[model samples]
Target: MNPVLPHNTLDQLFLSARTHFKWLPKPVTDEQLHQIYDLARMAPTSANCSPMRLVFVKTAEGKAKLKPALDEMNVEKTLSAPVTAIVAIDTEFYEQLPKLFPHADARSWYVGNQPLIDSAGFRNGTLQGAYVIMAARALGLDCGPMSGFNNAKLDEIFFKGTAYKSNFLINLGYGDATALFPRGPRLDFDEACKIV
Candidate 1:
């Protein structure tokens, strides 16, 4: 069996991690982005239908294209961050099922099923987005994930004529902890779970 992670590792990945709004002007390299995705992709997905797609906007021109799509509250922090990842879902992700899930003919299951396609794509893609965050944290990077943006506009600007649709955005870099607000409270397990 795999060993439990060390306390410090857990703390880095969860307990002490915060959503940062300010960055330290350090860059997140392209290699690090690739490492994040490489690690995240190894996690589970339904029928191996990995639908998540990412667009890392690190260039000034890319950020400029993305600016108008961001909500007012998200603009400054996102623009100032070293990298902002566009977490998206591929509507036609089943096309890769033959390669990703070679043991079964999974592609046929969603060939013309729009509802199933939408449901699986969004759910699995969002799960992968969470994996991305954990992977980034594991690699000593900070993340600020937010949904306060115009999805339709972002899709048009970044994914026009493609099968991809925006789900959320994550600003990534070394964070400015001095700018963090006090940590928020979480519900106790008793309040959020059941022993069924």
Candidate 2:
């Protein structure tokens, strides 16, 4: 008999995942942050064209720099968190398609179409970003992901002349339940998904 079988399950974890976000009791160490990236990078990406980039802001300077990028309502929260990661997408992800999906001429599919490149780059990068969130949870870190900031402003401040662009920002640390609000509702699967 084969030892491998389809016996994995995610229901228990999914069912319990309520964005409750009662943060941790201690700090999120630098070593642990490195482990999160080590796991997040393993997830699949389009043609291996990993478009995502992470700017981990933990030092006082880095965190302070991110403060101006947030809305007035979020600045204090972000500043309080132990760390914030700038999740970004590489506009030139296609340049790595050959290395990621060498089985076919995947590079040609995006080489000429600017729109197509943007679409795939953003899509896959976003996917990876989501993966990072889940992995953070799996690794015992609380996450507060937000996309309310200005993308152009982020590009101007963080990306500068680089090909990478910020997709969203995520605050990672031990939650301070003292400030946590009630859990938000979510649509049921039937309402959100269709079998057809």
Candidate 3:
């Protein structure tokens, strides 16, 4: 059996972690991004569908292309961050299920089913996005995740002629703690959950 994580590790991953809005000038390296994805990909997904695709908008040109899609509030923090990851879902992800889940004819399961494709793709893809955040935090980077961008515009700009669709964005780097507001409260376990 696996042991529970230590307190500091729990604190780093959840308890003390904050959604940052401002970033320092420090750069998040390509190696670091690769490491984050590597860590995230190991987490579970339904039938291992693994539909989440990422576009790390680190270059000025990429960010420029992404800028017009941003909501008014997300522009500055996004542009200033060292990297903004476009977390997206591949609508045709089941095409790879034969390779990813070879024990069964998984690809055939979604070949003609649009509803299954949409629901599983989006749900599992969103879960993978959350794993990305945890992996980033585990690697000592701060994250600012948001969904305020124009999805259609972002898709046109970044995913044209592709089956991928934008889901959300996560700005990444060392954060400026001085710019943070007080942490918000969470609902108690009784209020948010139940023992079945």
Off by over 4 Å in 3: none
- Per candidate, the number of residue pairs that clash is 0, 4, 0
The numbered model that scores best in lDDT is 1
Instruction: Candidate 2: list runs displaced more than 4 Å.
Output: 1-13, 18-25
What lDDT score goes with residue 79 in model 1? 98
- Tens digits of lDDT, candidate 1, 130-184: 9999999999999999999999999999999999999999999999999999999
lDDT, residue 98, model 2: 80
Comparison by lDDT, 1 against 3, better one: 1
How high is the lDDT of residue 196 in model 1?
96
Per-residue alpha-carbon lDDT of candidate 2 for residues 146-174, written as tens digits (9 for 90 to 100) = 88777888788888999999999888886
Cα lDDT computed for each candidate against the true fold: 0.97, 0.80, 0.97
List clashing residue pairs in candidate 3.
none
Global CA lDDT computed for model 2? 0.80
What's the ranking of the predictions by lDDT, best on top? 1, 3, 2
In candidate 2 the C-alpha lDDT for residue 33 amounts to 84
Model 1 vs. true fold: TM: 0.99
